[model samples]
Target: MTLALVEPTVDLYGAWWEAHEEWGPGLHEDGFGLAAGDEVDSPAGFTAWVERVKAEDSTCRWIVEDGQVQGGIALRHQLNEATGHIGYGVRPSARGRGLATWALGEMLNEARALGIGRVLLVCVADNEGSLRTIERNGGVLEGIRGDARRYWIELPAAGESGVLTEKGADG
Candidate 1:
């Protein structure tokens, strides 16, 4: 399994539409912020949307396994001054497999590479799984926002121990 930037193509768009049909309407990662009803139903439109994401100030990537898109992670920089915000979701079929936790680790690596020192994550207060995933990735509870919980994960410098890295006893 690998985390890859989603490429706009007919195959991917078709698969997404199929998932939408089966799972009901929700965030589609590719065209984040756009209602599912507004999602382009054409390959060309989907490609154009992807180009927009590449041309935008944020970055989004997908969790791919065996040629299937299991989930996605998106990052927005400069939020709250010196912090990047993370948004992620896993497909229902891919739930309960630790994919979100692993993906969060990878996203933090991306953040470090881009000089991001701290990341903010907000999840529904009752989302136990999501809360655990954030905690596992080193997020510390900062506070709560309405029905959401806010957490912050400070990126570690190389050689510094943090929840982002796992080591065996021999290390």
Candidate 2:
């Protein structure tokens, strides 16, 4: 079970779209609707979104596996001057492979080095795997906002030990 995380490129986006079309829809019943008629769905929106995220602060798009994309994860930084948080996510087929845990661990380490103080991850109430990923990364459940469960992992204050050391069971 070897895997690597690569940045999201145009080619990666295409692979993700194909995988989503094949295995994403109905995986969770009516949770995430599949792209209808090849219209503007989550993947398409995500492709454009990642580009926009790249324009600001920094955007990380990762492809899992030696050559297969599997899925992508990203850290979209918040730029509110007072808040330097990062938001992230992984693709469907790539979910249960610990890719999220690895990507997140890498992101947190990178964030710490970049002077970031915290990372935030949010998921729907029913997204158990995502919730577990965040928790394994030392994310503190910070209550819910509407339908989303917000979690936070405060980077070790300067000179403190980093919290996330072990990957989750899924990985």
**Top model number, lDDT:** 1
Candidate 1: residue 156 Cα off by (Å):
1.5
TM-score, every prediction: 0.79, 0.66
lDDT of 1 by residue, 1-171 (tens): 555546334467766555445545555442142434444667777766666665656667766776776776777765643223887777777778998898888878878878888888888889898899999998989988777888999997776775454457457
What local lDDT score does residue 67 receive in model 1, on the 0 to 100 scale?
Answer: 70
Candidate 2: TM-score? 0.66
* Candidate 2: Cα lDDT at 160: 81
lDDT of 2 by residue, 60-143 (tens): 655457566654455545543222254444555556877777777777777777777877667777888878878988888888
Q: Candidate 2: lDDT of 41?
A: 55
Per model, state how many residue pairs clash. 0, 3
In model 1, the runs with Cα more than 4 Å from the true position are 1-11, 28-38, 80-84, 163-171
| Cα error, candidate 1, residue 42 (Å) | 1.6
What lDDT is reached at residue 122 by model 1? 82
Q: Would you give me the overall lDDT of model 1? A: 0.70
